[model samples]
Target: MDYLRSTFVILTVIMTILTLLPFWRNQAWWVRVWDFPRLQMATLSLLFFLTEMALMPFGGPAAQIVIVLSMACAIYHALWILPYTRLYPKQVRASRLNNLPTLKIVTANVLMTNQQSDKLLALVEQHQPDILVTLETDLWWQAQLNVLENDYQHTLKCPQDNLYGMHVYSRLPMQDPLIQCVVAEGIPSMHFRVTLDSGDEVVLHCLHPMPPSPTEDDESTNRDGELVAVGHTAARASFPTVVTGDLNDVAWSRTTRLFMKISGLLDPRRGRGMFNTFHATFPFLRWPLDHVFHSKDFTLRDLQRLPEIGSDHFPILVELALNPRVGKGQRGLEIEPGDQFEAREKMNNAGVKSRHVHTAEN
Candidate 1:
């Protein structure tokens, strides 16, 4: 009985230590996987700490192991909750533009099998954003979304039932809209250039890759590979860019962070909050999977989560202001130079081979 108790206690300690692996030295890989089940980790950690305290009266090898496990779990819980503390810090100065051209973009994953087109159309009409991007779209979904054509002049539709299905609609003039297969078969992404009335150009890339799941794709490598490859492409582009879609990864994950660093884009949520968009039905088990990342040439005007439109994922609405005065020093969010090296290594480790495309036009 004593030996069994000891074994259980040791196993618990090991599991507690595993939770803290995210903060260990050079542990980006650890942090990537730690992104999942964050809420459950927090709750379990707290419960373990209380259990250890109650077991103090029964001093033995089991008690000692429980105490150690409790400490480790507590530390990890604290670390996991710390990143959100200064997510969106208060800016020292506000923009001077009184009449800035605010571009509102919305992104939603409409679940390919869902037939509630009326709810989605109602949400879009209510928001009236400048651009709308939908994931998991099929032929029927495309046909239903055609109602948006009167407001949005430009469209790029890749309506497939596969994991990569995507559709994009824009009120601004779009140039060279094309669907590019990023990594695996059936995973397509839409790329286009939006020409604003002020003559400023903004390149937009819409992506929706297959997520990692036991029943779906057993490996997350392809999804990670596709994002990194697209990140590299966006990084090399000269124009200001906005990459939006259902990324299938959390905003704070190593892969997502690396993508932001490599692409040199700014996350509006950084000084704000986690715009948790997935699993709309269960808000508690949600993470910010749908995102809008823009170059520093633009500043955030506003951002919010749209009401549920009968899909598992909620739509993200973001309004950005073009800062004409933003120059070399204030182009966008600045990431440490070392981050790029780490990002490159992670991408390589994920088996993402780099291939450059001259333009999305071809």
Candidate 2:
């Protein structure tokens, strides 16, 4: 019993520390990276609490304290994730304007090294999304998806072998198109206007920021900065906007919430489901890295996590109905205090030290 107590107590502290690491808002990869696994942390914390209770039902005060701390961590994470579950009120309302013009999009991250183009092609054909956005695409993926050009006349392609490459194909025509590296060099994001069947023009922004990881970036500064910069742009845009891609940040993360509020955009996932899209190969270790967020001017018609296509990510499909008259029923988020300040700091941190990069064709 003494041995078990010592082991579990130490592990419990470790879990609690890691769970609280993201609160520091530290940009270092090791610290900020913990933001991605809140769900997993909650699970582990709960398990530690329960197992300790069952195994050592009667321990000293220290043991009891450790158990309580574990439970606290679990509750902490659960509260953060609860808004995303059906139990909470939706931030973005359901669509009542089904008759209005709709746009369906499919966003996929075809691992740059993965060669299974047919699986993705088949999935795209099956859903037949009006817009298809592929990330981690290279010159090879560009050639394989040329067939989509037959149906999707308006296209934006920026194929980079560096794993940040992004490509977009749309059935609806695109205008005022521009592609630029918003933050770090070699990392690119695309922006443009899409004219829907209703003749309404909406700004579409596509991004796949470099994630904070040992193999990738050393900190979350670049990733968070890109999101901040885009959030400001979307907030200021004259027309309604839609932003989607593998943001490299989870839905529940602080950065993501800040983005939503700063941009005044709504996440269809809120009050829906996590719709975990990454690590398609590891079901237990997945989060919603791929996302689609839009202005309240639109409402959700459909959302699904499609079958994996030999990539680390599962494609996500979202169908939205656009009708300016209908969104008044939906709840919207306002920027919180310090949101602008923190966003500015993130942008400044990346801009001051990082090399500027530009890849554009307006």
- The candidate that wins on TM-score is 2
Error of 1 at 238 (Å): 1.5
- TM-score for each predicted model, relative to the true structure: 0.84, 0.95
lDDT by residue for model 2 (1-362), tens: 77887888998999988987877977899998888888898998999999999877787888789989989999998898888789988877677665788889999999999999999999988998989999999999999999988899999999999999999999998888888877767888888888888898888889999998999999998898888778877777778789999999999888998888788888998888899999999989999999999987888889999998999999999998886677756766777789888878988987832122221113
**Alpha carbon lDDT at 304, candidate 1:** 89
Give the residue spans of candidate 1 off by over 4 A: 1-34, 54-65, 77-81, 85-96, 324-354, 357-362
lDDT of each: 0.73, 0.86
Off by over 4 Å in 2: 352-362
Indicate the worst ten consecutive residues by lDDT in candidate 1. 85-94
Clash tally, candidates in order:
6, 0
Write the residue-wise lDDT of candidate 1 on 174-220 in tens digits.
88777877566687878888887687788888887776665556656
| Residue 137 miss distance in model 2 (angstroms) | 0.7
lDDT of 2: 0.86
